[model samples]
Target: MASPIHQRLREDVLASVFAPDEPLTEAKLTERYGASRTPVREALQRLEQDGLVERRGKAVVVRTHSAEEIIDIYESRIILEQAAAAKAAVKATALDRQLLTGLLTQMQQLDPSDGRSLAETNRAFHAQLWRATHSPSLIGLLERLDQQVRRYTLTTLTYPGRWPVVLADYAELLAAIGDGDSARAGEVAARHMSDALDIRLKMYAEDPRTL
Candidate 1:
């Protein structure tokens, strides 16, 4: 489990409270988080390991990914998500399936234009899917990839005409998992990541600032 200071800093960074490339000094962080110097320093170290922060010229700052790096992250996510979905189809227990169903229902009820709510629910749904796989190694890898992607702070679901497609994808993915259809689950998960990548690249091309 992450310490409170580390979790607080991680959440702020992922939420873009600290902008990309913003410098994070130990002294300032200690004051901001009401933490002692030791915990503040340790939290920064953990964030660095998580790839959310990095050292440059002896200063720690939020990590910023190049376009190429973003693409690479998504590509890795595609493979891992595909395998996770397939494994989850075989391994998901009754409780895991119940949790997934509940999250999907929450997502479906969200207004299409409410991007923030939709994104939050979508994240929970995916996290549940990862858990359903019952593989620690795979879950750890996916969590790291997720941490890097969340630092981007933009959802592909916010793209024009994307929300409905995402809903449909989730519905199909749920159905496949519920029916124990590993092949279909894997295919849907892979396609979902591919679609997200396509939208993300398009966004970057149109306006680099949007990302």
Candidate 2:
């Protein structure tokens, strides 16, 4: 298990509590997180290894991605997430299905204007899907990649007309999994990522802050 400081710092970084490219100096982090210098330094090192932070000249700051890098990440995610969904179709247990169904119901009932809630729910739903694959290596890789993506504060779910579309994609993916149709599940997963990439580009075009 990760040390408490490391985990807390990781969560804060992933949640954008620390903005991208913001300096993560040891003194400030130690004061903010109430940790000693050594632990804080170690936590920063771990976060760097996780790709959530990097040394920028003389300072360590939250990692930032360019448009080209973001696109590449999404493309890689499409392939890996496709494999994960396919594996989930074959391996997901009754409990996994139950959990996914509950999350889907919550998402369906959520108000469209609640972007924060929608983003949280969407993250949970995808995390559950990753767990459903029951592959430790795969889950680790997906979670790491997802952490990098989540460092960007804005979610594609908040884009106009995107929430309902995401719901539809989830419904199809769930149905395919329920039927144990791996191929269908994989296809749906790939298409979902592709659509997200397109929406992300549109969001960036409208507002660079979404990057």
Which candidate number would show the highest lDDT if scored against the true structure?
Answer: 2
Q: Please write out the lDDT profile of model 1 over residues 60-142, one tens digit for every residue.
A: 99888889999999999999999999999999999999999988888878888887887888889899999999999999999
Clashing pairs in 1: none
* lDDT (10s digit) by residue, model 2, range 1-211: 5789999998888777876668888999999989899999999999899888999998898888999999999999999999999999999999999999999999999998898899899989999999999999999999888888886735678788999999999999999999999999999999999999999988899988778
RMSD list, candidates in order? 1.3, 1.5
Give stretches of model 1 more than 4 Å off.
none
Model 1 root mean square deviation, Cα atoms: 1.3
lDDT, candidates in the order shown: 0.90, 0.91
lDDT, model 2, position 127: 93
Model 1: weakest 10-residue lDDT segment is 149-158
